[model samples]
Target: MTNPAIEAFVQEANDILETLEDQLLELEGSSDPAQVDAVFRALHTIKGSGSMFGFTRLSQFTHHFETAFDLIREGKLAIDGKLIDLSLKARDTMRRFVDLGGDNAEADQLSEAAEVKNLVAALQSLTNVTSAPETTEEGASQAGAASEIAVFDIWFKPAADDLRNGLRPDLLLGELEDLGDVTHRLDLTAVPSLEKLEPLQCYAAWAVTLTGATTEEAIKDVFIFADDSELEITKHEPPVAASEPELTTKTVAADKGKSNKTTAPIRVDSGRLDEVMDRLGELVIAQARLNQVTTRLADPMLEAVTEDIERLLTGLRDTTLSIRMMPIETVFGKFRRVVRDLSAELNKDIKLVTKGGETEIDKNVIDKLSEPLVHMIRNAIDHGVETREGRIEANKPEHGTVILSANQEGGEVLISLEDDGRGLNTEAIRARAIERGLLDANATPTEQELHQFIFAPGFSTAKELTSISGRGVGMDAVKTTVDSLRGNFKVHSQPGQGTKVTLHLPVSLAIIDGMLVRLGSDVFVIPLSAVQECVELDTLETNRESGRSMLRIRETLVPFLDLVDVFNYPESKDTRRRVVIVRAGNAPLGLIVDDILGQNQTVIKALSVYHRDVEGFAGATILGDGTVALIIDTAIMIRRALQQAKAQEAPSKYVAAGGH
Candidate 1:
């Protein structure tokens, strides 16, 4: 039989060991006594947990690592970077040993073990020989000395979430057989009635009595499955035999589990959740068809049933979407390792700070966002922040700050990567753009337009491409990845201040609340959150004297993008037009449309591989009537407008000054 308690212990141990190893590698250049102490605690936790789980091999191996580090802590061994590297390698070997089930047969495991033994030998040469085991309070406690035993009792209280993690109280009681003739007692005062039962909640506690060879450590291991449980272990001087009629351990244990087996939490896989979403989508479509039929029949009962089904479908969809949400921090947390390694390699003093990490995004989107975030951080350190000496000369702090934050705004998650460093160099960027043949020789672009040139392929302003950055790889990759996700990316900068890159992504790409609209021959879906208001466009009166058209909304002159001109659609040949006002970043634009089709809950489907690169089309969604409408990529459209705005602004500046 597989022991879940031991397996959980092994998994926890392995994860902690990996973190320790990564931290040790990060601590190579640091001489802080506090960090060394932290490293010792990590190894100590692994060793203690390993022995508890019966992984004797791992415990033995980690003991040596712990001893060597203890020597360093005590000043017996000198601190050095090479030693830290060796310790990190040994940590990796011990992880391999734990993974190998502590068996010594696999060639790779044997090789790693041999390497660890050699490293241990090298470390041992720096220490004085100890003929006998070192005596510490912990060692004395484990020795079962006659003076150490105390007479008391233990109360193990499991939390409600403990059972949801696959722990069973009765099964844990069964494992207590090793500590002598043990009697298990359980408390079950919180069990609710069947009607109010929640399967995931734990409703009991345990009391165990054991004799002979039993230590507090031994007793605690029996409840390994209940790690989050509140364990009160009062040491008893001698193992006491069960005697009281009211305290018969078997009777208490049996009674506790007897009344309640009715509910257990159901575990559903991700594939099943996706299946539920698909069924909900079909029901939504079917409900639309039913409403259409009922309109012709004018049946009252059919209308009521349709209303009920709509409510249920809406609930089912919400439940399914909630299941797919995971905190963005999971991906964001790994950047500590990246920042640590990059800072060490570059010899730069940089601190990473993250906020609003609890904000959730679609699981798929969070998974893909990691690479782009890493690239941006790397770019900030390599090219954005100045060198330590140079930064001081520039009257800035030596340690640069990079902040990654995410928060939900209405229906989309706004993630911003900002750095307090030198902003983009417009003169250098403009010159590079000309060198790359991306701009005219005599052209002068505004700061905002100049910043956009970095996203173009093979654009680098770095004097030479170092390992850290400047190879023209990461920025374009960020653009492509964000574009693929139907998200928008923007850059804002001010000289001598800082740069901020913002990414606006839908909460979940699979589904959204959308507003459907039509423009000439094509239909478009605007994410409902971005829609401010819709109004009629009487171009004849709204036209500028220079032939430009703008809509005045709330005393703001918002430029209107004629979808017909942008998409090359066949003109409606109508005198009047409808405009949908959408906001991206700080700018709002009026998108010309033929008609406002109604609100919809849309399930977005990605375009075919060939159409993936198509501009302005975020994704495709099927309408209630089965027509395919393209979801609008608002960010790309905004960028295109910005480019056009810049183009229209040029030449007129020189003419205004009478220099043309």
Candidate 2:
């Protein structure tokens, strides 16, 4: 089995690398001292932890990388484009080494790779060239002088669960020993009796006295990753006078005030969170069944008890979901590196501006959104944004801009990518659709309809293929992913202005507020957020003589769909039916059902692969009565209804032209 300590090191190293990239990119804009220190500290922690966990190759490589940042920290080296570029490249190389699990033959080969050699050479050259003769002499003079050797009284107590989490206190103490002369003592007063002792729990503490020429910063670096540990350090100065021979001691409590005043949030494994959510879903289903039982019994006390349980369950469900919600900014931070690299490759000046990043969504949704968002940003930079010369010719700013923004709209989150570049070419797209046989040559499609052709598989307007996007697959993949998330996207563009694609998705996929409806003996659910109103279906107005499926609601022409016909279910025998009017985009769609079964809080379960391809159904859920009901994808149904109306109208239009 793989060592858990090594695994933890690898995971932490990956996290540090990600943070380093963000800091490095920020350094490019402004070289803030705090950011520089953060970069150095991250590298130091990686190197220190890598050494303890058998990542020798990674440790050594980061040692050199850390040295370069150390110079920046000490004001010996200046932050420049060349240094930042080298740092970013070196960061990527370090990531590869970390991936190799340290000290492997492949890592050795990578260490000797040409790119690695060049980066090291470049870094060494910077330090050599920037080191002035006087500065070197001054550093030599300081080293030659008798450095003050101070004694530090150190105490460390690891948390009970620290060892189980893969913390190696011995390795940590060894690291401290390398810093200076040390005498150590172990305190086992907290250890439990043999019968009660837990092998994995850490109950021992340590006290040590270290005499060293090292600074306090160097000593603290040893425990940088052990934030949960209780640690204290006291500095004891050497005797002020030989005659008196008395040392002065000053005690410094490590984060004592902060620890006492604040509570730190615990880091939880996502898998555990998922398990809790699954159990909560089962409880919700059971509670719903209890409600059904109580209502049937019609006992006052039982009904009151069931009502209280329902309210408690509702609150519990909301709290569980909130635990899985994370702000979108976590995904936004990585895009800066993308835009920077793309701009360099394409030789175009572009900027990415993001807003509403604090808006939160389900973690699962955010995880799946990264790739689609990357593809969209790449498309915007490669195709949407005009080149520098082209922008100048159009009297626009030389630097094009892409704006990524998100916000919450009721039960859904709306994420939009807008680019100020050459927008969709409607005429060109229309012609391309005809050439690709996606549309009739004589067909005249509206701008919105024509714009959709960009999402068609293998559709492209580019004359030649490039590394970026000529082989048109990006937007189509975006659509597929959004659909899988039960979300819908809209494309709006104006030639010479810009293009904006907005995605509307539910806040969570686990549960939703649904309006249950009956179709024959089967039941279906419509997301309550999409429902506008319910009205009685008029059979006379919907008869064959009218040749129309439109319902006029308060001066608006709203199209309606029979759920039975849409799902191809058997007809119902019920004489009365209701129409649930829902707003889809700017249009209102009426869904005709046999009866309205009232509102329900549904725990959504995704459809199996076999039924996933079936349109007009988002997923399935179990009702309070233990019956299965399919959740309606109202957006898809509305689109289908409109398409059917268009198909029927086309034949009539052709006949009218023939008569004319």
Candidate 3:
């Protein structure tokens, strides 16, 4: 079994490393003191925690990286592009050590690897480069940082119960000694008789005399994270006269975490949270069942009790969901490195601008969101953005811009990756589609229809392939992931303007507010996020002769599909029918159903493998009466309409998503 401390350290270390990369990137532009301090604190915390948790190799590697920041803190060195590059590379090395579960032979081998040796040598050289002539006042301070001149006395004793909490006094002392010259003696006076002693308890203390160019606060920082420990430091003044008694400065350590009035976050494994969410979903279903029973009983007291349970369930559900809601910025932060590295590799002046990062979404959705976004970003950089000279010739800025923005709608989150570059060449795309036999030669499709072919399998407009993209798999993968999430993807581009790809996704996949509708005796669900409104099907406006149909509501025409025909269910015999207006690919899609049942909270369940490939349905859910109702996939319905049009070579003003 892994020690809880080690587990916590690993989680915290990964989080720090993620933030550290962004911080390093920020230094390239700002390099402000506050940012520098943040980077330093992150490294210090990781080094201290790694050592405490037996990640000795990781701690050792981070110490060299930390030393560079220490120079920056003291104004000895400066933050430059070269130093940031080294820091980033060294940061990767530290992450590798952490991932190795350090202190093992593999980590030891990595510690002596060629790459590790070179990185350390480079950092040491950077430190040496800061050492100017000792004649200059600034250089003198840097030169004597490690030289023995100033003197200090230090004492430390661990809290009796701290060893059980993964305290390592020896490692702490070793880290301090690295700062300067030291002579130390161990004190075992606290040890009791052999019969009375507790083996698990720590009964050791240390007293040390140090001579170095270090300050009292610097020495005190060695025990920074060892809260509630007996630590004292006294700095001895240099002798002014031969007979004068030496005066010293005495200071005691204070608790660090409590100095800030914020409580430390408790890290629970994601799996545990998922389990809790699963249980909560079941409770919601049971509550629905209870509500149904009370309505059937028509008892005042039972209905009142059911109301209380319903109110309580609502609060619990909201609280549970809020815990799972993480900011999209966590993922957004990773893309800075992506943009930076890509800029270097492509030799293009490109900028990434992000907005609305504070928008929140489900962790599961965010987890699957990164890969597709990366593919799109890569596509935008490689294929969407033009070269600097080409952009200049086009009367555009020399540098290209990719704007990644996210915002939450009523029940959906809209994430868009838009680029101000040479927009999609619709004519070229149309030509390729015709050549590939993907479109009817005589049929004229809209610009949006031509753009859809950009995401088709094995589709590429590049004359020659590069390592970045052009295999045509990038956009195809994006579409696949989006479809699986039951999300909508729409592309809007102007010939000279740019292309913006917007993904409309639900805020949560586990549970959603769904509109219940019926087709004959069978019931189905349409995600409320997709539904715009419902209106009466005023007329039987069928166009089978042209293999197309439309529904006119007020003054607008929408492509409409009958659920009965789509699902092969019995047609409704009612005198009136209704159409649910759903947003699809910049236009409204209408779904004709027998009748509308009221909306309800839907707990989504993945379909069994045997039924997973069934079209027109996203997932299955248990209705209030305990029967399974398949959720209608609005995105799929739109795509199905698109495909049906192509099969018939129908000419229309709009096209749906599956293939454009």
Candidate 4:
């Protein structure tokens, strides 16, 4: 294997290690036979492949660790807390050995060797317990019984260069003979004419049949050193009532057994896929350039071909990109470990139920979302799930429930975190708002109004300082992080049922479908998710609302925000107005614009630091016409509109009370 292959092996080995660790951790608190088998298989695979890749130190360490797990697998050792703890420690040590290359360095080797020996001794003692009556006497008897089972039949025809490369066909056959009793037959057919055959060339085919007490994997171990040379092995199921003569096949011998599925198809790495996508992107841009260059040719046939090329390239690009798309389940699986550890640490009984984990999203988006997800999970365990006694008083289940789910809707993906515990305390939240001076003492805030305070900077409701919560930060940072990825965040809570936080993120942050609109002298782009509809605004006369136009859509009055006032745009003579209905969470507002330009496929670029603080603008994008357009942060704008609407309604409250 080359360096890249080695790195790939390391990555796969690390994933298996993580799997083993998590299984052991769960087994520490409970006894599960399935978990034991899973842990053993993971360690065994690592040991086998580690040796194949020349990581001798890793192979030796994992081999010893696998024996301990094997004892548990065979019912000789019952797993306990002490065994699980030592297994986790040993797994970590194997990781270190893999990361730090060789065993020749004395200082590191001495330390690791001591830990390995101690863990091995502990494991051996666990297996040495006196025989329990539950164990059947026949189990050990079955281990010694020998039964010959027919394995695979192989057909081999080596190339002329096989002998020159020092690969002897007879040597492979001899290894098979050691595995079990074998019958071999040589065929001279296709050997070619003797006058044309070279002395250094090999041209012979052979068939062999073998029977053994071991598995087919034991047979493949013999020929691991050979590349895909002319060799084929087919496993034969033993006959029940009828008997027939089978063909001769050959098998090789090795330390470990060979697997029947050794020649499985290989998959490309994401880095290679990314490289392909990059080239495809360039192809798309070049095709766009070609369309531009050919427009002046005045040939309909050229235009037709260009259109065909465009369609082909678009299809190719989408196909290539879809290869890198994976289900969100790959990421959600890791959180099981996080929740288990946090539950134990906080002394909280928690169960995590996940749904819609198979929802597909861009791989890049998944990677960037991991850290924010970790934070959300930690917060759910620390603050969202109430303590055991607290739950009983509230007439809820003593064990709290936290749910993580992902679903794809339209062009965006929605990830939600929900818990069944005591909900956010709005009274305490409002008091904190006043104490922090975010609101005045005289200010009366609604329930929805109070919940928004949790997203304010340096705002949290926890009273006492603990390692988990009460650090004076929470939703605000989560909001900021999601916003950075061009995503939207919303929080919902009932008085006692707990809280639900939803994240709406684009499938790919690099590109999106946006609607172009003109605001004053500047052109802006709004994501499609925010746009409900576009309509002509009519003036409202019943309320005698001045300067503001309201549209009645679906039997509800939607207020309009004038872009001229918000953006401070220069004067324009076109009085004809258009309303772009936008939504954020449950709130919707109409954005009044001078013109609604059409749909655009936008590639987003970041705004400079000086312009990042500009409210209501998330990022900027360049159009095909070489014009720069700003993308609106519709969530912030909708929140602002809600507050503005509330303030506008305050006058009616006083009027109803006769203005005392």
Candidate 5:
């Protein structure tokens, strides 16, 4: 079995490193003491805890870095560009050590590598101070005169089952020995007789007394990961002249009302959460079946029980989904380094400003967002943001700004990345589209339509290739990912101002509230988030005379698509057909269906390989009658209608010109 404590360290180290990057990037602009102190504390925790957990190499490597920050904390050193750059590099090295799981063959080799050696040397040069050697029993006695010595009384007893969970008290004791002059005695009062002994159980405990210039906090950290054990630390203050000895005793419990972890969150593996969601999806399907049975039986008691179950399931679903939801800031926090590095590499001054980071989305969606957002950021810098001199000439600030913002709108999350720089070159995009045979030469497409050509496969208007863009694959991949998530994107640009790309994505991909509609023999689900309103269709006003299918809701003439024609089904003979108006981008389109079924919770499942490539259907879900209903992708269906309309208009326009 994997060691839970080590796994916890890995997770924590990842978070610390991410925050470290953001902190270091901020340090470049401001030298706030609190920020510096925060950085120092983080490094000290990693170093101290790293040592206690068998990461000797990582601990040793981080000592030099910790020393540098210690000097900066003491006003012995100052922050500069060189220090920041090297510190960032050192932080990267620390991440590598953590990723390698510390104190292994790879980590051993990394410690001896030239880059690490050089990084350590550069950090050492910052303060010209080498780390004090590890405190030894004899060394502690000699150093006692130099600093006020602290005496600690430590006692710990591992839980009887801790050994089975991979807790090694010996390692914890050895780590404490490195802190100061340590002496200990074993307590075996709990040890059972040979006849009753359990081989894997821990019965012995330790009482250790240490004299060192270290706080009780440092000693407690030796057993930090052993949260299930019992631990106590007492400090003995030195006696004043002619005074009796005094002591301040603090009882620090490991698992029982532990001082440190009272408010700490319980970290769970996301894979387990996904598994719960899958089981919940099945429960939803079974609930649908139950609802169907109760409806047929028409029994009052069964109906009452069914209603209670429905109410409880709704609560369970909302609770489970909220557990999976995380703030978008988790992804947004990563790009500070990206922008900083890109600015330095491109010799441009660009600042990244983010807003609405508190908006939350499902974990699964956020996991896939980082890469596409990175690509978008890269393009914003490489193609959108102008050079410093160019900005000066354009009467703009020397520094370019890229703003990434996200917000929840109804049932969808809108994430937008916008930059202030010379915007899209429409003429260049249009020219490239025609050259690539993606657009007709004689066609007059809107600027918006022309701008979308950037996402076309193997499409670029760049004069030359750079390592970043001109490969023509980044935006295409982004569009593919967005579409796979059942989302759509829009691009808006002003020639002299900037370009903004906005992605509209569903808040949760696993389950959603949906409106059901029937098309011939098929029942289809439309995401309730996109559905505006439903109306009874009046077949008498077909508007076939105008050579178009349209509906006038109030006064607006909204185009409508007949499912009988769109899906090639037999014409619906029902005179009471309904039109479901759904929002698509900025326009509203009407979908004509044979009947309007009520709404229900939908569990979305990915399509099988055979139907995966097919358009218009997002996925399939089980209905109350145990039948499969195809979920309509509203945005895609509307876009398809627009494409078909455009295709028809092309033939009519050519015929109007009297073309044979």
Candidate 6:
């Protein structure tokens, strides 16, 4: 049987392990006392709770892990690279134990594994603390020094069904005893008379006086996993002299003051957030329909009501999106560990500098972004960064630097990974491209064009495959993921300077502000963020014999694409043909359409598998008039048009050269 309590414990333990990693990594950069305490407390919590929830192996393993940090807390050990590395490995072992979900056979095997033995021995060696038998009660009391002992009055009352649900009060009390000298009394006043008592009901409570050099936080950690229980802890000052045994209550105002400052946030499943967003998208589509109907009615009160609805919906949408928005720091924090590990393994001195971590992105985007970012970071370390010796010869610092930054740019979020190393070798990339038949040997391509070849499947400059990379799948996967998010990326490099790749993604995928346009009885939606302005396609200017489809907007010549020809739609005879000027990167493109249909709040629906392969259309959405319209991927269309233009110019240039 799957015990719900055990399941919850596993989930919480995993979360703690993640946090433990971050704390350990942070501790490496600075020997912050608070960070050290946090790490110790996390390990202690895992050990205490793991035993109660049947994670015997995990609990036993963490006990040893906690002892190392305990020594650090007591000034018996110092933070160093060796200790941090062992802690990381020990943390991973604990994670594996938790992953076993208390399967005794597997847990036993893992507990006896050589790796676990090595990790424990390594951890013990650091503290010079032998593996000795000790009870939880003894451990808790010995956790803090008697010289600095503080007394705490702790009252705990478990829920009526807590015992049935696997609450181990005995183990909890033992853990408390482990913290210090303890005087605990069971309050049985609520227990029913034996004749009328229900055997399964919990009718007891506890009041305990604990004197130790432990903080209130330590006491709370004892009850961390028992959310259903009522716990109150008050700290009292230690006796001034051994002869004067009587102690007075010390308010410890600072700790008490922090309790009332903020409300606790509830843990919510991300699946529920996704459901809310899906429903919100549907509500938006319905509101668009109502707005369209109200426009036709032209009644003053109805129009006012429609306007109010729109405003309310807009506010609700913003609020919902904000709820799903998480600071990008959550993702950025993990990379510190990655960089540290990679630097050690690769034997290179590389520093990771992050900025703008407070920038927010939708949770969904953040979840999918981690893997791609990991690949890019690895690529930067393994390929882009030069060896320390190479760096010295290049007149650079011995250590290479990788900068990971995030910020909001208009309606999109821009995340960039830049490395100050030997930038991409354009000549080498060009040669590889020609050898791979990705480019013509005789053709001259721009640096950017040559860089694009790196994203092709199975494209790599590595002479041999290493465990880190060289399979040539990392960059290709990055491109695929960014494209799936309806985002685009750009690469820039200066040969001996560095390389920077920036990704541009929408703030939200559920709803978008789109411009509606029509072409030969079909309606389409263009992302409004990309659209600059709409202008009439002058026939006289377009008919010139230059054999180029270009539009002169003001003084700049921008490439233009006819939607009818691009999509193979029947030609429209509408003389009122208009062109929508949209910017893609630094270049602008004009899209020719039949007519303008104003703006819309489009609830974007992802394309079905059947139509997903279609090049230009990003997705489909139902219009207010009950018609389905395809959403144009402005970035894709602009790229396609530019490619076509380049192809056309290529042939003409070749012919001119042949004539010469």
lDDT of 3 at 573: 93
Q: Write the per-residue lDDT of candidate 3 for residues 1-660, one digit (tens) a residue.
A: 888667767887998999999999989988687898888888888888788788989988898888889778766788888898899899999889989986999999999999899999999988875363224566466546545367777888887777887788878877778777889999999999999999988899899988777766567667766755777777665544667666454434345435553655677888999999999989999999999999899999999999999999999999999899999998889898888788778888899999999999999999999999999999888888888888989999999999999999887899999999788988778777777767656777777777888878777787788999768888889988988888877898877788999998889988999999988988899998888999877564544446657665666667788888987877679779888988765757889998999899999999999999888789999988899999988887887776765566545333333642
Candidate 1 has a TM-score of: 0.71
Report the alpha-carbon TM-score of model 6 versus the true structure. Answer: 0.88
lDDT of 4 at 48: 57
Evaluated at residue 114, the lDDT of candidate 1 is 64
TM-scores for the candidates: 0.71, 0.88, 0.89, 0.75, 0.88, 0.88
lDDT of 4 by residue, 313-385 (tens): 8788677667777888878877877887788899898988889988988888887777778878888788778
- Once fitted onto the true fold, the runs of candidate 4 whose alpha carbons sit more than 4 angstroms away are 18-38, 52-54, 79-93, 101-124, 127-142, 146-299, 520-522, 538-560, 607-616, 639-660
Best of the two (1, 2) by lDDT: 2
Rate residue 377 of model 2 by lDDT.
96
Candidate 2 Cα outliers beyond 4 Å, as residue runs: 129-165, 168-213, 236-263, 539-548, 570-573, 651-660
lDDT (Cα, tens digit) per residue for candidate 5, span 191-230: 8899999998899899999888776656765665676678
Superior by TM-score: candidate 1 or candidate 2? 2
- The local distance difference test score of model 5 is 0.83
Error of 4 at 77 (Å): 2.4
Of the candidates numbered 2 and 3, which has the greater TM-score value? 3
Please provide, for model 2 over 1-660, each residue's C-alpha lDDT reduced to its tens digit, 9 standing for 90 to 100: 887667777878998899999999999989797999899999989988787777778888887888888777655678888888999998999899999987989989998989888888887887775453334565555543325687888888887788887777888888888778999999999998999999988999999889887666777888887767887787666754556543333323345536554665555788898888888888888999998899899999999999899899889998999999999998998898899899989999998899999999998899889889998999899989999999999999999999999999999999999999999888888778777766666665567767777777777899889988888888778877887787877788988999999988889988889999998788899999889999887642553323557877676677788888877788877888899998755557889899998999888888898998888888898888899999998878877775666556543321110000
In model 5, what is the error at residue 565, expressed in angstroms?
Answer: 2.1
Tell me the lDDT of model 4 at 255: 16
Task: Assess each prediction's global lDDT (C-alpha) against the native.
Answer: 0.71, 0.82, 0.83, 0.71, 0.83, 0.83
Which residue runs does candidate 6 get wrong by more than 4 Å? 1-4, 129-154, 159-166, 179-183, 190-203, 209-221, 224-262, 543-548, 651-660
lDDT for model 1: 0.71
